[model samples]
Target: MTGSTGDFAGRRIVITGGARGLGAAFVTALAEAGARVCFGDVLHDAGAALAQQLAVQGHDVGYLPLDLARPESVSAFVEAASQRMGGIDGLVNNAAITNSGGRLAGELPVQTWDAVLDVNVRGTWLMCVAAQRWLRESGRGAIVNIASDTALWGAPRLLAYVASKGAVIAMTHSLAREFGAEDITVNAIAPGLTEVEATAYVPGDRHAYYLEGRALRRPQTPADVTGPVLFLLSGAARFVTGQLLPVNGGFVMN
Candidate 1:
């Protein structure tokens, strides 16, 4: 847990869907490490509360209302974050949407697919595009995209969510090559069955299936994934790009 001389000190970081779940964990960890974090989320009440709580702790954390379903909102949030934090050095594309209910593909509505794709894929892409310009200008920047292990192993009954995460994995690789020459390492973390508020929608059997394969036989927390995220966004992972590191508890060993 010993960070390198506050490696993120004076750095500006932007995280999407950072009000709760794993996204909030990243914000807290980075802010504690001395990074000025500007986060956006659709959950206004939670976002505002988290920001106020962190500010009380003397952390430079700012929250903005953002709806990832709209590309314009994503762009505007990034723009405002860049302006607010001075400049962008890192971005954590963690915003996503799951189906309202545990509906399988055969019974899932097209709207469910559209909703998931809009936020997980399109929103992530737009955020990266908006942040890319500033990251390039900074000359030292990194990106850590949040993907899911379900995408890699294929989760049943959650087709839309899995598909969107699969798209995120593909996007991360493509962007890594596009921004490699600029010295910006683009990578992803594919967490497996992490215990977060977001997983409340996951079916009980599905969760059991995920746990059965873990060597550790324990549920993963946001803290388990935060280390890999910070590593990717730190100087330590400069040479590591176009890689998807799994933060699962040995659930899906690839």
Candidate 2:
């Protein structure tokens, strides 16, 4: 699919946490693929700069401020994205946050747990709810939720983040059934420990373990995670739903 960049021409999509890292990669790749894109994130300046940069390059792209921890903000983001793109055909649930590294479940405070679950889990469902009608209007709507392989392999030293992603996988199945009759497909993309700014806190040894254990024996990049997301958002994945696709270079293969 990388051979042609306009496969998604005319498609309108909304993505969460598109200010940087993997989210930024999705935003960039989708826009270059000819999709009308609107992405929301709490990082106002970064999001705006990315949008402006893309727009200057002649891509139909826009950005808005969003705090996924708040219900009102999630609803506003969906609404704003719909208005920007004229309509919505897809939604990417990518916004998430994690506390400092190497904290056990018991060591973590309740507030940390609440914050992660609030944005990673609850925010995802709220986005789907708010985008329901707009997706239905598109005839065939697709939703791609960004999950983590940590949940699949029971990665150690991560409590709240793992639990939240596990919930995302389950929600995908349930939402797929709920949105099926409306011609909406729900799916999740589970990526391994990727090399993003957010992952910089990870220990050097832990990162080495990831590279050594994976079949590819190399690091995973945001670019590597973008193609599968694009496919899941495209017509090619119309028959695919309620499934978790891992993009971790053969790490944690099932």
Candidate 3:
């Protein structure tokens, strides 16, 4: 896609986990692309501040507090965001938690497993279900679920996180089939190890591995994943659904 695509102009989009990291980038990029965007996150202060900053630039952006682990909040967030946006057209499921990485499956506590599944898998599903009505009303709705390349390559010591992402990919396929009749496209974007605030604790050697091992031989950034996401949300990808697009610089080819 070029800089001139009008796919986002006058559109309304809702993003989760938009307070920081990759989600923050999505809020900025989509709003700048001419979409009236409302983002939700657990970080009330940061999310509000981002919305304020974007509004100062005359961008149509709003923020709300959302807790993905709480199932009831999904429908509530969508209803509120749609009211703020006057309607809804797209959803980006980016909220997730890994809860202190680097633990074997046996060492990982039950709470860790539950929390990961509740937020990463169940949360994404509920959000989609809640937003489907608004999306159907919009007549050209789309969804982009953020997944991880770790699920594809079976990265070690992240059992819960990887499993949750794999579930997301599977749900994408099934949901795409269900929503196809409504012409609402559902897709997943699996990104590699990206340089973001959420990844600050990653070991230096791990970062080095990603940079050297990928075909691009460089680190992936928040911006690096935006183009593919925007394309999926755009009119250009209207016919593209139930597919997983990897934006990891050729790191996990399937």
Global lDDT scores for all candidate models = 0.89, 0.91, 0.92
Clashes of each: 0, 0, 0
* Candidate 2 lDDT for residue 89: 92
Q: Model 2: what TM-score?
A: 0.97
> Which pairs clash inside model 3?
none
Clashing pairs in 2: none
Please report, as a residue range, the 10-residue window in candidate 3 with the lowest summed lDDT: 1-10
> What TM value does model 1 have?
0.96
Query: Whole-model lDDT for model 1 versus the true structure?
Result: 0.89
Candidate 1 residue pairs in backbone clash: none
